[model samples]
Target: MHSDPSGSTDRIEKDIVINATRERVWSTLVTFFWVDEGNLGTIDPKAGDRFVAHSAKEGSFPITIEKADHPSLLSYRWASAQEGAEPGEGNSTLVEFTLTERQDGSTLLHVVESGFASLPSAMAERAVSDNTYGWEEQLDALKKSVEG
Candidate 1:
């Protein structure tokens, strides 16, 4: 978690090591928890693609891809505060996933989500707090899913 002196979170960063190859982790990640997994066959992600990430406990979030580089990096803009709204100029945050493969075939997965400071103060505070917890749980889930 990265925050300013006033304790407002403008960015969130987390990394975890998964006992799996980078390629395997990447495939699982790109397809993780979408309500509609139909189009995610092996999840060959690309820039400009749009999708919704759904969680039964958290509803749906609109996502627009910004970058995708093979099994290494994937980044997107997401409207997490305004659920179901399209991500755009002032309403979204950038979320990036970076993967590094180790010599032992394991993977180091790092995630960074930034741009919350651009949102309304209260909203930014809530979004940052909620997502701070969310990432911890999500990463644990990802590790379990991939390692299995």
Candidate 2:
């Protein structure tokens, strides 16, 4: 549902209709995959939890779980690992995942990531490119996880 008007990384969006219930999809988007499956990186799933994951060849960056809405959405600020990183530097993108129930019992999952401009020049481009591919692949994985 994003216009992608600027065609910049600022307007990135990934949406999918999973064959699971809205609640189930929400759980996948929030808890299980992250904590159990190690989706983003190896970090304990907890608010204020912080860890480093080597990404984009930039060593380890920060990952903090800022908020979680069980069975609906989960959001957090991800920090980049490169040196000279600002306090919030390498930290951009308010990523959100929303789940809605469809008429036929399917679940509509919406993913939006904003504020990519905050990343360092090199990492910003790399992040967008990498995530673009990653999201698509993850969607397929999600489908199988829920449908299987």
Best by lDDT: 1
Q: Which lDDT tens digits does candidate 2 get at residues 1-148? A: 2333345566369989888888767655554353234445322355666544443434444556666666676666664324324236445556677777899999988877666666555666666776777678777777777777
- Tell me the spans in candidate 2 whose CA falls farther than 4 Å from its real position: 1-7, 32-62, 80-87
Off by over 4 Å in 1: 1-6, 34-41
Top-TM-score structure, candidate number: 1
Which lDDT value does model 2 have at 72? 71
Find the 10 residues in a row with the least total lDDT in model 1. 32-41
Q: Write the per-residue lDDT of candidate 1 for residues 18-130, one digit (tens) a residue.
A: 99999999988888543333344555788998878776667778788899998999999998888788998778899999999999999999999999988777778888999
- Please provide TM-scores, in order, for all candidate models, with all chains considered together: 0.89, 0.70
